[model samples]
Target: MKITISVEQPTGDFQKKLLALLADHADDIEPDATWTKERAERLYLALPTNARRIVKEAADRGGYVSADDLRSGEDSSLRGHSAAIKRAVDRGARDGWWPATLQSPVQAQGPGFGKVVGYLIPEYLVEVFQHAANKPSRDW
Candidate 1:
């Protein structure tokens, strides 16, 4: 059975009991967490500078980076990198580096259909991707 538990500020006893239960099932548990550090690092390493920049931008924004802001007459970093980014993500899935069911960490989102305001990294996943990059980003 698959189980997911969300605990915040768990007590010491609760933590110990959880660990004991997990240890007992360790043999049956397969590593399937999406947005894992290793997987994120691998995928990030596989991407080109432009694609990586897009990821960093979204991550730096704490999830969503605006595409409306042109950089001194330049197009948004996400503008020309979409296809290459998609290919890189697909390759990662095919190579078994990341989970096949997981969608691209960088996603285009907006208020409604046909209106793309920016790419969102997902608040929960920003930290993982940032940790994977392991570097400071330039001003975006």
Candidate 2:
């Protein structure tokens, strides 16, 4: 069955919050270069509990995080609900909050598992993340 799903993009206010969060962690994200294990770990440790979970789980597996990982809480680090994370990611991608690259229906093997969609955080975003960190927070 072919189906289309629609999600509302984040509002300017929310986007600003996200940007502030990104900027706050710009040093950790190291936006100018690719993410290395060391860099990822630093960011992982630096993130708030919720974001940490998502980033750690994904970074541990080559910078790609699947919906299943988020939903099932496969990694102990994942704190937020899968649906919420999914929504935030969808909006972030659509609104250009960050530059994570997303893909759908990648193959997998396991019970209760099937093709899955995921996101990849690139080095450039890492750089932006760092730059944003230096920016002042705005009230939105």
Model 2 lDDT per residue over 1-140, tens place: 33322335778998898779878966665443233333333333344555545444554555466755566544543233333445554554465443355321112223444433554544334433333233343332
Query: Whose TM-score is greatest here?
Result: 1
Clashing residue pair totals per candidate (backbone < 3 A): 0, 10
Off by over 4 Å in 1: 1-33, 70-77, 111-115, 136-140
User: Lowest-scoring 10 consecutive residues by lDDT in candidate 2?
Assistant: 102-111
TM-score of each: 0.63, 0.29
Estimate the lDDT of model 2: 0.44
1-140 in candidate 1: lDDT tens per residue?
77756565679999999979989989987756577877777777787887777787787778777766423355534455645667877898776666556778888777776656778888899999888777543321
Total residue pair clashes for candidate 1 = 0
**Which residue pairs overlap in candidate 1's backbone?**
none
